[model samples]
Target: MLASVAAGLASTALGGAASAEGGGVPALQLITLTGPGTSGGDTGPGELLARQDAVLAKVGNPTTTYRWTTALNGFAVELTPEQVAVVESDPEVASVEANSVRPMSARRTPVPSSAQVRQPRATGGAGVVIGLVDSGLAPESPLFAGVPGLGRGPKDFAGSCEVGEDWPATTCNRKVVASGWWVAGFGPERIRSSEHLSPRDAVGHGTQVASVAAGNAGVSVRMRGRTIGEFGGIAPQARIAPYKACWGAPDPRDDGCATADLVSAIDRATADGVDVLDLAVAGPPGTDTVERALLGAAEADIVVVAAAGNDGREEYAAHGSPWVTTVGASLGSVWQGRVSVVGGPTLTGASRSRRTSPPTRLVLGADAAAPGATRRHAAQCRPGSLDAAATAGRAVYCERGGIGRIDKSEAVALADGVAMVLGNVRPGPVVDDFHAVPTVQLSAPDAQRLTRWVRSHDRTSIRMSGVAPSPVAGRTAAWSPSGDPRSSVIKPDVVAVGDGVLGAVPDQRGWAMFGGTSAAAARVAGAAALLRSRHDWRAPVVRSVLATTAVPLGTESVLRQGGGRAGADVRGARLALVVRTPRYREVLESGSWGDLNQSSVLVRATGSVTRRVTNLGSRAEYFSAQAIGFTRHRVRVTPLAARLSPGETATFRITVTGPSTPGHVDDGWIRWRGARGSVTRVPVAITR
Candidate 1:
């Protein structure tokens, strides 16, 4: 870990931490401050810095410190150990942390397209501004050029713009209305050849995210001079304001979405007066600076949407705050292409297909290996570890878990293997991803069966279903993280079209595919912009509509899929489930789970709560309410038959009858189902 230099403490004159590169002189260091909530009021960054400087002058160093107020009231200064000791002892200095380098939490969504919602009308996102705090935004793409009548921006917009070397100042048009970059003392070593002092995207992540949410329709996509197709974002008419908070790291290849940079970026975006802030980034589990910024954004009536991250853990499911609707990734059925083994156990998986690649004989890697390496190393399929002469011209059977699937494929390809059969080491769904070679991964059991056949000297021939079927792809992408049952908060408010989503990118005539929660968040953000353009509801109600009306892939965890996939226009929802008190949102004083404090309804001898259901459909609808999934204590719901006329509403009392079990808390949701195929849930909690 790179750390700040802390030196020169003997003397009173503040000789702050000196740099390893620069001679004896001290370098700038981040110093965070806070007031007693009362003094903080109306105490701007300048005043705070002035007060701190006064303290420093009296005690040690008299040099002024650069201050920041937008991302929180903070300052950067070079103070000697004596001065630092005096500042740390001050009553108003709540806490101070060194600004350490943080990695990017890299990670989809498609609710709007499935909802049968179409492109935006003139009023679509008319006055809405969607701000993106990311990297790599290409203004040259035709997506921002806009169509004749719809591209003109809102009349009341309050924002400005900036340009980079390759990016012309005139490129900041009505659609892409604003641009700004936050460069935190970045020296030339970290700068990309194409990047200037401007806010252009040297990295492709920000551009892809921005286009997914707000770029206009009918943007052309081409690869190798051939037009693959055309693509567009959810809200093509919404105005975009880009903030370059993240930059390519010191290597000029990897990038760091640093907290200090992001906080400063948020401060700027908030000041820019954006209606919706879309960021496809998150850090480790905690209530850090970003969460505070999100809360502040929410309080200002700005809807904040963020990614749940790609860690794929059941517990500590990322993005815990309710104020920001957290998004998770899922694959569209179109992402799957069938691959099988003839004269073998029936196998179902996805691949780019061997039909497109050079043909080779099929054999288990162990069967084809040369006499030297261990069975484990050969099976792991590590590059350079396998004997190329023996395995050449054969399809390698490599086990998963030890290495990246792509790395295994690359190894096999380098070893002269025609294709690769990568099998899971543990139980997991078939996760279909495009590999460098025509490769397919099998589930553990399936792989085991194939291994047995190979060792038995039985003939095995692999086949390909060159064409992808139109049916639902085999389950949600197996890697899509689902929520654990321990926490009461309903995570991933929704999933979206994340698998292999094609969108326009930079580098003229370029197009690329994206997956993970970042893609999902962008899709939902665009839909939110569209909804905001036409509705009069506030942020909470908007979030509620997005959460409840979402469609789902049956059998996937409700916690992972939330309300399922999001739809474009929320008004199209036929039936509405309304709960006056949802346990997840209620604030509490003591008991907590992760970052969420539980304030659930107390379960009496017979636990019961009243829930109101309304028929939002044009005609009458049949509905039923029941508790779904497992619970430590059995959760029961009454009124299996709930019939309602249009505009009519009824209340259902749900009860938790069983005795408290071993777990300290009992959590469940009231799942309402309508004959019209409508499904929604409201979480409930009961504590002993």
Candidate 2:
């Protein structure tokens, strides 16, 4: 519940709210420019973006107005509202949106930690380079400190730290091989005043995410100022090159990493010969600058993994393009303290607030707001609206869908409310969130009942205490799944454990708890790095192997779970099936009315597509393919089973005939299996 809420709040809180340009006066807002370069134009995503430096210089004071967005046509500059209008007048400008950043965390890493779980002594991902494109790195963290066999940078890597005034020139070390920052955001002087002068992570997010992907092994997890458990990254042996695309962390949470900065980092990482690029950032939809850059990275043989945005409500809100390997957030097993209503259900949430008084004197926020504000605003717990006279030292009832859960807690506490009960607007399940005051989120039905009770009953009370581990462990987080039905493209390509993962903070000895698809993408990136270390595979092969070998979650739909939970056991299988054919999402996009029906694809059409299956094991392997799930159309695979040598690939032709009927989605997978349960499932969704 909080993950989706936090996503919105994170955008608002991290990137300061954009002040409107009133009276046609000059104001600071991100402006995107597009068109053929009149003065000078560059072709292609890379060259076009390089031309942006010149375009930005022409529009505003270069030093103060930061240029965002990578490609030549798109940019975020502080232009006058009139100047923005001037840009809009250009026919070439594709689209423009206000710039913002998403809050994106650590744990054993069910990762690099999971790798150790299977082989306790092994630190996976030797000889691979992983580039972290987020906040800069804290090279001094124990996770990045030099050690014997560990901490060695990949010799082929060719990137260096962009030193800051505060960051010593020697900041780049063997473990943190490279570092750079793109702070060309809305505010520069203010950013410099509050931010460190170098690529160092004053904001802890980049460090935390990088460490989660390839941090050194055997770091300890601390809470309440004491060690609770040992922490590790997914691929402990991979080299880390920090690319600080976003900045302003550790305070005010300014993660407004513009597109220009991201483009530079990605281009640099690709040139530096990194094996994988890990990004925890997101941008507006459509094929924008960074989206194009990611596609370029994919074509260059680099594995690009990105987060499915935290927005659970909108469809295709995720920043992922077609080629990138998109990942979604799933729960990791966790136990947290509970806060339940007197007659309501137990809720799963986290808070640092300590409640000393007996649970009683329940007061709803709508009842506490100052006069004139609607009950809805009161339930939203808008700041300053709550009257201290009405709700002093009582647990305030707040709704989840309106504002960030933490923001709600702050508003209630500001009103002198002792605690907060966050009721979820969307029913079914809750994701835990860290809070400033005593806060617990209720599920939908429970929240609805709590609201009715608050309206009907003058007095309400609730019980609070520690609770058992959440019953739903490692389930697809509601916000993690892409719900946009308008776009037929299936997403997240796969799911990974992201909730409550632990990783390093910028503070020398500090650590943090984060929950989002950002962490999930990092784990998958690290897993890919681990695979890179063991096998010489193309980007598609790596993606296919991971998807095929993943532990399929049987409950969720193919769109929700994709290939299931990521579990790439490089050491486990002697033969793995890698799918190369119509992508699951592509088939979905091809359907009419979102299905292969007579009204949609009215003509019964026949199409033949070649599916390539590769055996990536150490020896020759035998395999067969079967179409399982709903049969909306007829599919025939010639030579269903085959024997192939190690590293050899076989091609199978699949003939499909469109059906006469229409349906939501005909879901199934082309399953390929080998000895020892080595299996690969290419999820298929077509309607007619």
Evaluate all candidate structures by whole-model CA lDDT and list the values in order.
Answer: 0.61, 0.62
Candidate 2 local accuracy as lDDT? 0.62
Model 2: residue 33 alpha-carbon error in angstroms: 13
Native-structure RMSD, model 1: 8.9
Query: How would you encode candidate 2's per-residue C-alpha lDDT over 1-688 as one tens digit per residue?
Result: 1222233223333223222322344433444445422111235556655655555444443222333232223544444565556556655454544444544422222221111111122388888888888877777787887665663346567777677656765776667677765544423443544566457777677887888898877776554344445666888888888877676743554445655457657766765668898888765665565665565566556778887766665655465354567788776654445666576555545433334346667788877887777888997898777888888878887877677566787888778887788777885545444454566667787677767776787677876665544435446877675533345445677788777666788774577666678888888999999888877786667766666666666656666766778855745544433422223224323433222110011112346555566666778878887877655677666888999897787777656666645435555667777765676776655543
Tens-place lDDT per residue, model 1, 497-597, is 66565555676646666666777788899888877877655565567667776665665656566667775457555554432222222332132432332
Candidate 2's error at 491, in angstroms?
Answer: 1.4
Q: Candidate 1 — number of clashing residue pairs?
A: 13
Cα deviation at 583, candidate 2, in Å, is: 14
In the order shown, what is each candidate's alpha-carbon RMSD? 8.9, 12.1
